[model samples]
Target: MTIYGSALIVFVLMALPLYGLLLTSFQPEAVIRSRDVQFLPATLYLDHFRSVLAPGHIVPIREGIWNSVVVSTLTAAVCLIVALPAAYALSRLRLPGKNLMLGAMVSVYFLPTTIFLIPMFVLFVSWGIDDTFFSLVLAYAGFILPFEVWILKTFIDRLPREVEDAARMDGCTHLQVMRHILLPLVRPGILAGFIFAFILSWTEFLTPLIFTSDIKISTVALGMFRSTIDIQVGQQAAAAVLTLLPVALLMIVFQRLITQVLMAGADR
Candidate 1:
């Protein structure tokens, strides 16, 4: 009963903003201009959706979408590339002071990313890559690597050592065992890490704001600010809704995988 009550309360809290998002998205511009907050609209309108889809802004909605997708996908991919081996080493190998290194990594993760913004910007500008897609991907991947490493490390730690040993005994090389056996076994954790990294990059406002100057390379989160400046309330709501669409679709598609991956660590 206590759990049910707590769940109901949490649901209501989450539902409130979502309800407003829906209501505002469907409301007519005239209704919005009147400055009244109506929980229920008598009717629906979609001119806002049309406008959001149109190309009228400094950064076209389409291009922002493309840039965001590219940056996020690359960040996720690159982060995993860096994290997987490190995680495997920490989990399976007799690395020197592995616990201390992990604690340090966790400390880095917990440290406010904003603290590094100015220094990172300086480094990027020095390297002549400031305001570029690569800069954003690098920044996001750096920030996301710790979590991905930790998550994958947890997953790796749980795998049976006997299986890996058996594979080695069968003349399977270490690379072959990892590629064929271990990676496939922990795929859900990897997928979850990818999703996490992607979403972190996608929704990130600070890193993109600092690193991106070209409208052509701007992301959806930054584009929202520029696109909605002179737009009506309804259109703004539509833009917000559209920004959430890809994330929503991703969650819908990977919900089960994410659940399994998250649960896989919880039992430890």
Candidate 2:
């Protein structure tokens, strides 16, 4: 096919689903009930959006959104802080049992989260962190850490050692080299890791389901499912759409950065 044809094909494939979602979000219940579904809503209705945003809703959808934002942001920040240094050390330093340490970190990623749910629940309760925002944040951080470390480590490994060597020759310490030289170079990796951690925490359901009993700690995903179980389809759809808004916005705002990060290690 011609270049223009390929571009048109890509645009349609990407735009169609988003158009459908936007159309569905505005649709009234009657249209949904109609045997034949149209591309556009016959009558626009904001009731679903209002109901989902309503204060009296079983799960305060706005609060759930805020909780999710907080949890995801904190999880991403923590993952970056912990993962960057650890990944750099693992990638560049020749510490004893380096392979074993890397193996252990990777192994954690393969372990089923379900297997730890009960134990984590008990630990949270024992620590008096259950049903708290901190509990959820901690759980999310742990859940995202292993994979974040591995993803970033690969990128860090690809960084040139000459940069660090020059910094050292200038009488710079390892910490100074990392702060000034390494971080600037590996920013794409950091962004990628942060985005991955945030998405994972934002969409997590099982950990919050098992650990948090209070609405305060409940995230958007948990709240959406809770509303669904009560047969509130319209509101549920609204909540889902709202939950997706930030992610969609992030992808749009940082499209170039995300694209670069995604392709960073491909040349290797």
Candidate 3:
């Protein structure tokens, strides 16, 4: 009961802001600007959503959404493609200095991401891909790959080697075993990694802010909702709610698997 109460408290604390944001998104601009704060609006307003989708807006929300979808999808795919094989090697194969390499990867995850921003931006500039989606995907995938590798490795480590051994005895090669057996069993971990990679890439702002000028992802575009003289609170709130939908939906759908993966990682 104590633990359940504590969990409920934590959920409310975290959800209060989201609830307020959702309410504000549906309130009129006039209600938003009013001195009185209404937890419940008198009437639902659709103008904010319309304004957000309206053409010739200062923030190209449509384009931003498109860019975010493409970049996040690409980043997730790249991380999975690279992480799976790397994880299999790390977990299964006998490799020298494997522990050292794993420690180094974890260390990278701990280091402040800010330190890499300038150097990465400069590197991209030198490579002449500074303002391109390619740069955004590359940067996001680089930062996220280590975590993906660790997640997949954790899942792979938990699997029984007897399965792989059996496959090998039946003339199945490593590639065949991975394709037919390992991948199927580790599907949960793979889904978790892909969803996480997509979420991280979708929510990432700094890399996109530095790497691209004209190409704005939803995160950067949301930041553009503010200015010195005036802030578009209504539209911003609507956009925030909209931008949050995909992630929210993903979490709702995969909450059980994600929680299991996280618990497993914590145990490890």
Candidate 4:
């Protein structure tokens, strides 16, 4: 196919779902209830958005958004702080049982998250962190750490050792080398890991559902579940759209970094 044709095909593939989401967000309940599905709404309705954004409805929605943001941010920060050094050590330093330790770290990803929910909940309660943002952040960090470490290790392994050696020759400590030389080189990996951690934490449902009964700690994913006996499909759709905004914005803002990370990995 021609270049323009290929571009059009790719655009269609990406645009359709976004178009559907936009259309659904504007659709009224009656139009949604109609037996035949339509691409265009009969009448545009802002009620769902207004209702969701209004003070009465805003409380749960805002709380959920805030909870998600806080948890995701902390998860990303903690994952980077811990993973970067560990990945550097694994990639750059020679240590006994390094393979075994790397294997163990990778093994953590093999176990299903569901298996740990009950134990995690119990531990959180025992620590008096249950139903708190700290608990959620810690859980998210643990959940994403293995993958972050693996990805970062790959990137760090690809880095030239000469720079690190030079830093060390300059009388730099291990921490200094990591801070000044290693980190700047592996920024794309760190960005990729941060995005992954944030997305995982933001969309996590099971842990939040199990640990938080209070509306205060509820995430957007959890808040999306609160529907009356008679479901409000339009409102739910609106909520889903709004919940997606931050994630979408994140992707847009970091699109260059994400693209570079993917390209770098692919080149390897």
Listed in order, each prediction's TM-score against the native is: 0.90, 0.86, 0.91, 0.86
TM-score of candidate 2 to 2 decimals: 0.86
Candidate number achieving the greatest TM-score relative to the actual structure:
3
Worst 10 residues of 4 by lDDT: 224-233
* Cα lDDT tens digits for candidate 3, 1-268: 9999999999999999999989888988889989988877778998887887676566566667777888899999999999999999999988999989888997898889899998898888898988787888988998999999999999999999998999899999889999999999999889999999998888887777677776344443434443212547888887777777888898899999778777887785
Give the better candidate number (1 or 4) by TM-score. 1
Q: How many residue pairs clash in each candidate?
A: 0, 0, 0, 0
Better of 2 and 4 by lDDT: 2
lDDT of each: 0.84, 0.83, 0.83, 0.82
- Give the least accurate 10-residue stretch of model 1, judged by summed lDDT: 54-63
Give per-residue CA lDDT, model 4, range 125-239, as digits (tens): 9988898888888888888888788789888887899989987998999989988888888877887888978887888888888888888778888886673224477777777
Scored by lDDT, the top model is 1
Once fitted onto the true fold, the runs of candidate 1 whose alpha carbons sit more than 4 angstroms away are 1-9, 260-268
Candidate 3 TM-score over all chains jointly: 0.91
